[model samples]
Target: MPRPGSHKYDIKRSRLRNELDDAGIPDKRADELANEILRNPRGLRARLTHVARRFVPRPGRRGT
Candidate 1:
């Protein structure tokens, strides 16, 4: 059994590193970012920016 929070991937780590390197990122940077991606504690949900939402009009409102 895999440990808690383990990432499941078909590709080996060396292959991933090579692919990242092939993608034009520096080897060290790619490896660091890849490790961070797999081991991130906060999970992979996209974080929203702090921008205010647009004013959406409510449907079915009575006409004044």
Candidate 2:
């Protein structure tokens, strides 16, 4: 069974992923940002910025 707050995190992650997609954020950056949050309880702004980095497209070659 999922513990308390587990479902909430899932919802939040989904929302964040959707937002990142809408914003055209790269998959790697978006995943990194989401994983970082789940991995630790860090500052708000820093985490958000990290997620935002995904939006920036890279030149040449497809991102993994």
- Model 1, residue 59: C-alpha shift (Å): 38
Best by lDDT: 2
- Kindly give the stretch of ten consecutive residues in candidate 2 with the minimal lDDT sum: 49-58
Off by over 4 Å in 1: 1-11, 41-64
For candidate 2, list the clashing residue pairs, or say none: 25-55, 26-54
Q: Cα lDDT for residue 21, model 2?
A: 59
lDDT of 1 by residue, 1-64 (tens): 2233445432444565676677566789767645544455354233111111112224775423
CA lDDT, every model vs. true structure:
0.47, 0.63
What's the true lDDT of residue 22 in model 1? 77
lDDT of 2: 0.63
